[model samples]
Target: MACQVQLILAIFAALLAALPFLSLNSFPIRRLLYPTCRCFPGEPCWPSDESWDAFNKTLGGKLIKTVPIGAVCHTNQSFVPYDAAACAELQAHWNEADTHVSSPSSITAPFFADQSCDPFAPPSSPCSIGTYVQYTVRAAGASDYRATIEFAKSNNIRLTIRNSAHDYFGKVTGAGAIAIWTHHLKDINVFDYASKHYTGKAAKVGAGVSMSEISQALKQQGLLAVIGNAPTVGVAGGYTQGAGHGMIASRHGLAADQVLEWEVVTAGGELLTASPSKNQDLYWALSGGGGGTYGIVLSMTVKAHPDEPTATAFLQFNSEGISTDLFYETIATYLHNTLAITDAGVGSIFQLSSAYFAVVPILGLGKTKEKIDELVQPTIDALTSKNIPFSYESTQYNSFHDAYAATTVETPVAFGQLGGRLPPRSDIEFSTTSFTGALRTIAEKGGLISGLSFNVSRMPDVPNSVLPGWRRSTISLVTGLIWNNTDWNANLEAQRIISEEFIPEIDRVSQQAPSSYMNEAAAREPNWKSVFFGDNYPELLRIKKKYDPSGLFWARTAVGSDTWVEGSDKRLCRT
Candidate 1:
């Protein structure tokens, strides 16, 4: 007993002596203790059940504890019991965008989802929420938005705003955060819009309104609004705020150019209207400043144009009978005429692979079938000259909606990495060799190339914070590197190739400074400030500070995101 008491006293003395030297800044101690981060799950600061229950009551019982849809595949999960039938259904639709969009916590980009609860994994494999938001508030109105922002801010919880979850950069999901799911806020109203800036027909759409829904609604009213090329993208969310482009962008302008007013709930929980005449800075920033940065958007009233006749065409060719050099030459010829086609009031989207090239649709607004044929004849001639066998089709529709429905390829949710660049007209017209050579280099590297070519310069100039590169830019080229879901090394290599290989090749010949569509860009983009927002970044940052002083909203590569760093544990903390 005496010996044991002496040993205990000696250990206590040693600990007390070492306590003087112990420091919070020392090695692993700093990381393990006193981490200045947002409250994470299992932490004492995390909200209690009583607090959550009270908050749910405040939201009118809208709060939902996240249960990953994949839970249906795993029997071990306590929150969800496995069901064989439901698991089969989920596995079938795992790759579809709607499967994720319709869910409260799922995002289209699985890479960001951390593969936490993959439905296709072994049925016995454990299922956890992983990086998905822990709680979601299905926000239906301004009150819900206000309550969510206030609660997240007060609780020091990371807040994510998700509508449709069609984000490519994982902007719609965050770990240890609570989300305001605006998916059910599907309100649409069409009216004769009159504003101080101008007067015209317009539609007020909810944040959750998808492009397909708005198009169908407006088509019935004999009007149309500039929407995303993809049918599932939300109009008033990231699509428009990131300066949405569509088939008719050359004729009408980007979706940002069409905006007349925005109804948003600020970080202070004050609902405000942003337009040219009121809250002008917020209006300017929100138009193209990137979503989930400024505030939670309730709805947007945008200018709608009268429905018009449109012509659509499709062209497809491959390298079956042609030499590699000849195939590239044919592609080069078509790419060189991008400016001319857009100048003639036509826009087009095409897919290019090492062995295949297909222009799914060429949009000719206010033009006839013959006009579209004339515009595409040069490309057809190129293929003919090379003796390349191909197929071409053309059709004229009474409305843009009809043409869009026929030609718009249903974009599936791809689990891959995407790197993008906006090659200006000057480069395509002058440095033709270098421009096409870069694309060939990327394709040769097993990268799939997707191109959207148009002239935003042709649109009515509306001052917004969209990438200035869009003004002079003729094409937005995205290079995709897909990898198997189970292979971590392959995924890392794919991302590395896009960040280190594909983008640099294009930059060599790109006339403008490095710029890309923020919504569809590299995960590890360098100098994102200038690349995504350009000279407008400084002003955008100022507006972000003014509206969201607490940094209540954040996303990957968003405005002022540099102010914080996501920790090793995925808890966002001040750098």
Candidate 2:
């Protein structure tokens, strides 16, 4: 009988864990160290059924109960989330790039990184709620966002923001909380008149607008927006928030530098217009401080450039006859001469491994194939001297869209990943010996290396909270190790390596933590304040308090997240 009672209690606990929202009797915990934490650890706080119904009615029935995307392929409960045929289809395409992106509840980052949800594996096993937001308010406008914010604040309910869910870190989801899904807020408005910041063509993009949507739309108007190469990434989501970098960075500057104005719903339940001339503090923080840390963005306007023709250089070579010495020499030569290459108006993605090295660069607007050839000719000559087996191509595209489409990389979901960063040019240019030594040492660590170099002619006038390393960084080094999504143990070891072993070795050599671009680095990065935001962190935190004093917004490793920690139950419990 005692054993039976224990079993019943365990089952009761499981039900509570899975409950989306609670009854009205859940009063605030006075003993709680973190006042902003709406739910108690292991004792979730949920809204009453009546309150929930009211909230749903307020949104005109946009709210939906939590049904994780992974539930389709597998389930933690006795029943699956879908029919057998649908489950089979999900399993078949589980590892594809777009499968996860298009799914409402799927997040690009490993869902069970915290190891909270049982059978936490992707598609194959049930992606139990874990730390994911329990209820998603599919926001259709600023009012929806504002309404959601007010509810979360007044009820002391933890809130998470989800747009594209392409975030590498698990910022978009939180365990046992309300979520604002801005993905449905798709609105695009164009302007030809002058504004406080810029006096040229501009695009007023909704928070849910994606890279491809804006790209294709602007292409028809003979205009272009500086954006990442991915087709599914949300334009105003984490992309621009982390100071987005891409093929056109050399020509147009980082995405954060293009912002002219932003429409946001703050923690105080008021709608705001943030720009250079208004709410300057919020503007700076929102520009690149990292999303989910400030407030929910409703819309943003960015300067648009004339859609022009582009030139590109592509090189792919197998390390068939390449020696270790020759490989390092090639890497060293590129590092030593990045200025000249980027000065010629080119941005590149270099993927290297012991077995292979590939470089695809999109030249700037108005540049020609000869110019592309002239810039990359040196690397080609060096490889030629080394007798390296190689193939090269230089092409001219009539539109930037054409050039961008040719070399865009689509990263698949379901694989666990992390990055090792390289500091700015001052660190890379420490000395020839130091530069190449660090490069060769980290590169030879065995994996893939994705390198990015940024060269800019002009920057926006507003101050931003982007990583200080970006100001001086010429090249960023990133390498990732992947494991089968179903192999939980392998995923564990991979995450351990990315945090404990991989990034540390590179950070030791590259001045500090892998500070490449914040959005793409490891979420559990050490001393992230100095690495991701640098000196700007202090001010960003100040602004965080100034606006959202309750610490209402929190992401895995965003600025000012040090004061809290996530528990095994997936709750952001106070320390």
lDDT, each prediction: 0.86, 0.73
Model 2, residue 562: C-alpha shift (Å): 2.2
Which regions in candidate 2 have their CA more than 4 angstroms from the true location?
Answer: 1-36, 40-45, 75-85, 111-127, 427-439, 442-444, 457-459, 511-514
Measured on C-alpha atoms, candidate 2 has an lDDT of 0.73
Candidate 1: tens digits of C-alpha lDDT, residues 231-301: 88889999999998888888888999999999999999999999988899999999988999999999999
For all predicted structures, in order, the TM-scores are 0.93, 0.89
Task: For residues 210-292, write the lDDT of model 2, one tens digit per residue.
Answer: 89889888988999999986778899988898888877888888899998888988888778998888999999998988888
RMSD of 2: 5.3
**Total clashing residue pairs per candidate?**
0, 6
Report the Cα RMSD per candidate: 5.9, 5.3
Best by TM-score: 1
**Model 1 per-residue lDDT at 553:** 86
